[model samples]
Target chain A: MIQIKEVVKTYPARDGGSVVTALDGVTLTINRGDIFGIVGYSGAGKSTLLRLINGLEMPTKGEVIVDGKEISRLKERELRQARQKIGMIFQHFHLLWSRTVRENVAFPLEVAGLPKEQIRKRVDQLLERVGLAERADAYPSQLSGGQKQRVGIARALANEPDILLCDEATSALDPETTASILQLLKEIHREMGITLVLITHEMSVVRQICNKMAVMENGRVVETGMVSSIFSQPQQALTKQFVKELQPSTQGDDTSGEVVELPLGDADKLVALAKEHGIRFSVVSGAIAGEQDDCLRVRVDGTEAQMQAVRQVLCGGERAC
Target chain B: MLTGIDWNQVSVALGETLYMVSISTLFTALLGIPLGVMLTVSDRGYFWENMWVQRTLGTIVNIFRAVPFIVLVLFLFPVAEFLVGTTLGPTAATVPLIAGAAPFYARMVETALREIDRGVIEAAQAMGASRLNIIWKVLLPEAMPAIVSGLTVTCVSLISFSAMAGIVGGGGLGDAAFRYGFQSFNDGMLYICGLLLVVMVQLIQMVGDWLVRRLDKR
Candidate 1:
């Protein structure tokens, strides 16, 4: 559904000078109906890649092809028309604060100049799909972060887009919310056969929904393959760095004596592996099994919204005021 | 009570004041907003990138913006007279009001329009909204509250400028007070006019604040 070939983008420095290259010859193809994932840390050109797919930022060089159309060559009029078929959600959710949930969802439809009845029908379908039917009348400021993302999800789906591009879509959500959203995307993809693309620093994002994964570092795709392959045996060092969590220590490793610094990415995998091996793995050093260990070292899930809820609950809801 | 203070005359003068200020405010908003949107569309990187177009439009806007209202009134008398077929009446006076302050109002509107989140613009563009639809549906709607507030501010500014119109022989409350208060030495009438202007400002401010809040309920 989406094709990017040798795309390059450069932004000039703040002080009249040389340019900073954001994307350096990124060649990627996301098959239709695939939940494709691009994983990277900050400044890995993930966002730049996302914008190119949506045709928001034209490639400084090369071509971005969506469906049969070359989006980079499409004019503004054609681009907006093209974008209607490709829905996107942001990390921040990007809900218009002035508008209520329903209105925010209605914006794209309104922009597309869709008829009122069709727009309403689509919006209702989307809101129901995102499980935000109850909060349609509420403003974004009144909704929780997860709820806002849900609304954004509904909005993104309003156009019945053939491609859904989520740029850290779940990053601002809690774990529970992220899982729900991931499940929602999976459901939508399953039912409608629409292609979904998500980029994040969180590994679980790929684990849960993405069937295809690409590992990016320094604006280049180091590895791209099936999700199970990348998780089981990552070829690139960076990919391995991301997938280290699922690996088990060789059968005779001495974890019974004391806590050891295991090279695991997330706590869930650590626990699962330890239980599977029937070994007593103590996390005593660094952030191995402490409070911080609970967080994904890779942040592939990109759902950052849980931290606030955790804080609110831990602080007895008083700090939320 | 001052011996010669005519309360009835004060009321009529207030009526005239209301008439003059209302007309000027209407013209400013009517003419200014479209001008501002034009400025936004005409600039480089948007539409028609001709440097001469940008320069000519910028110079026209700046010429009006930089001139004082008092000078613009005097400068525009011929044009105002030609437009309205009268050089010295409330109706004729509006031409100068729109000409003198429309650019300033447009500039304020342009700033307000620009302050809208660029994300909204991108989102609109991504959705296949035409340039006109982007303006009418997204940019204009998003900037509505600010534009309304800007209009209120422009109204208040127009009320102040109306006082300068009195110099062009368009007799309104300002002229009444100037003749009856400053020149005729009617201090009580001057005070009354000052108080009325204050009340008018408060009314405009109250309505403006309420409108901005209503439009941006969040």
Candidate 2:
């Protein structure tokens, strides 16, 4: 479990006359055994937040409490000890190219001062878990991108960390490779019950694996909630844009009607209400005739007054509509 | 031409050259590597980031590196005399040789260490490796191939420095050439010493290249 409390991180600008705030009063709590995904555009402070969790970068202000220890205030020696329980993977895999796969996996174990024989056994088991046992003798350069990530995963797990922070672990891979890597991460989480904190720019990555999600913009968490609820009912403008991008569009060129999305069970009630109000409505996509879908998207043809009325009812006085 | 050359003296000079180069190179590697690692780690944003240490070491290495080997040897005559009790043989010449070549090799080692990916070092840090462990296990191992290549270049330069050492009565092939060849006008001794120096350089380069090839995985 990790709790980031009102953290603010700032770096002195290159000019040395001013500062750039990377994270502005951001607060987040990631529960144990969670696949928590932080999504943002570049420079949105997601990576900064991830680094804070492991004490890799200390906060300019506020506390980072991981497993009940205040990481930001710890000494370097104590921080190193704390870091052994928190493993991280990077976008580039960050593998030691000079070392063989087996040796690379043995690195953390060696750092932890495990015996040579025990390290060998642990590395063997980890390689087997990641399915990279056959390529143990190869250097990082000899492996493909996906295989390199598998090695990264095995190395991260070598210390048996309770929390695994993935900083765009799949961003460098092809889509198929990304899928396989995500699947691998999912399996690792299930088997180990380790807490996973993943920061990525790819919304689909969060959707595929994360149970909880946070949307960040300009060093602030604009939205954070369960993934399912956020997808169904996005609160902020940025969250709405992210969700809209994932929707399957049906009215491609026809910009003539007002499109509204609601739960599938409410579609009939909305249709009867539209008939009572003498408004014409048609199901544009999602859930066509006896097939159940999570969301029911409908296009309504009406005047400005009718459209406003329909929006008022659907939004239930919320500003998102 | 071959009959005019003193084969016994030429063999002795070759042995002296080998002794000077081998001894100076050993000391150079031992001193230069730690100096180079210090220069790298004490740099800005590195694990041991200390501005004072980095700048002080940088200035020292630069001062030693900027001086020509011949001038450095002459300047260090007292030091060689004090350290070796004489400034007249292959053994005494190593004082100036290491002083000149160690800084030169340290700079090269710094460059080799810099060529490594910073992310790899950061990855080691994230794994909770101690700073000493990171230096020995990660930085040194990762930069080894380039370091070995740099040492090879340093060794070749040390060979030439030892020849300069010979010019000042530090007995080696250069002394033989100057005494028996140039002064006596034998010409055969001069040609033979030149050929031996060339052969030594070639052998060093071949071994260096082979080691680099064997070590580099990237």
Candidate 3:
């Protein structure tokens, strides 16, 4: 379980005068056993939020409580002990290239002061769980990117951490590999009942595994809710933009000249125009690039009368119509 | 040409060179590596992130590295004599030799450490590794190959620096060449000393390269 209360993080500019706010007055709570997703574009402070939870970076204001203890207030030694229960994986995999896969996984156990034999057995079990038993002896550089991330996952899980923080864990991975890693994470959460908090820019990632989600923009939480509700009835403009991305493209044409924008709930209007006027129409494009309006482009193929009716509907009896 | 030289004296000179270079290299590695690690970890946005400490140590290393070895030997002569009770011979030369080369090697160590990805250090922290564990287990091992290569360069540099110590009665092949060849006009002795120095540097490079290749699994 984790609770963040009005947390703020700021960094002094390298030029030595101004301060840049990385996260501003953000408050959120994650329940135990919940796989929560924090979705944001780059520089939205999602990664910074993850670090606060792990006690790697302290917040400039407010508190980050994990497992009912304030992590920000903990001293270095105590914070390290607390971090033993909070594991993390990274976008870059971060495997020690000089170390073999097994050694990489075993490193935490060794650091925890486990017996050598116990560490070996646990490492073997972890390697087996991640399906890296065969590659245990191989160095990280010899493995593919996906395999490297798998090693990261195994290494993070070695200590049986109560919470797993994934900072863009799947962003560097291909779609298929992302799916498998997501599935593996889901399975781990289910079996171990560990809390999973993943920060990502990928909408599909949260849709695939996260039940609860927070949408962040400009270092603030724009919206937060169940993934299904957010996908269906997104409230904020930024939230709607994210939801729009998940919509499958309705465009069915090989060639098109122009595109028109549509707000949500306009598919019926296009369908009616086509049915009443006997016009052949298809939704061409889903959303345009860097535009506020979430739109759908439609291609019309019809007679002059039908075209005129469609134009009237589109223009709403305005000057163009 | 061979008959003009004393074989015993030539061997002694080679031995003295080896003794000075090897001993100074050991001291340099012992002192330089920790200083370098400190410099890297204390840098801004690094693990320690102490601006004043990083700047101070960096400035000190730069000051030492900028000084020429010949001048450094003379400049440190009083301190070397005070520490070792004499400013002459190979033993006394190691004092300035280490003082001169340690900062240079520390800079190399800093560069080697800088080559490591910061993400790896963060990952180690996230895994509950203490700062000591991260430094020892993660940073050092990850940068081992680069550090090894850097040490090779440092050792070869030390060989040349040790020869410079000969200007102040620091006995080595340089002193032998200065006394026997350059001073006495025995060009053969000078050539032999140059050949031996070159061979010493070559041996250091070969071993260093082999060690680096062995450690670099990536």
Per-residue lDDT for B78-181 in model 1, tens only?
88767888888677667788887788888888888778766666665666667787677766777888889998988887777877786567766777778888
Top candidate by TM-score:
2
**Candidates, DockQ:** 0.38, 0.68, 0.58
Instruction: Sort candidate 1 into its docking category.
Output: acceptable
How good is the docking of model 2, by CAPRI class? medium
- Better model by lDDT: candidate 1 vs candidate 2: 2
Task: For residues A1-321, write the lDDT of model 1, one tens digit per residue.
Answer: 788999888886766877888889999998887889999999999988988987877788889999989997887667777888998887887667777888889988887778999888888888888888888888998988888888877888877889998889888788998998888888888888888989999998888888778988888888997675466446788888787643445334322232222234435654554454443443332222222232221211112343232223232221111
Interface RMSD of 3: 0.8
Sort by lDDT, top down from the best: 2, 3, 1
Enumerate residue pairs that collide in model 2.
none
User: What is the clash tally of candidate 2?
Assistant: 0
Q: Model 2 over residues B6-91: C-alpha lDDT tens digits?
A: 89999999999999999999999999999999999999889899999999999999999899888988988889889989978888
Error of 1 at A209 (Å): 1.8
Writing each residue's lDDT as its tens digit, candidate 2 over A14-43 gives 856778999999999998888899998899
Off by over 4 Å in 3: A250-321, B1-3
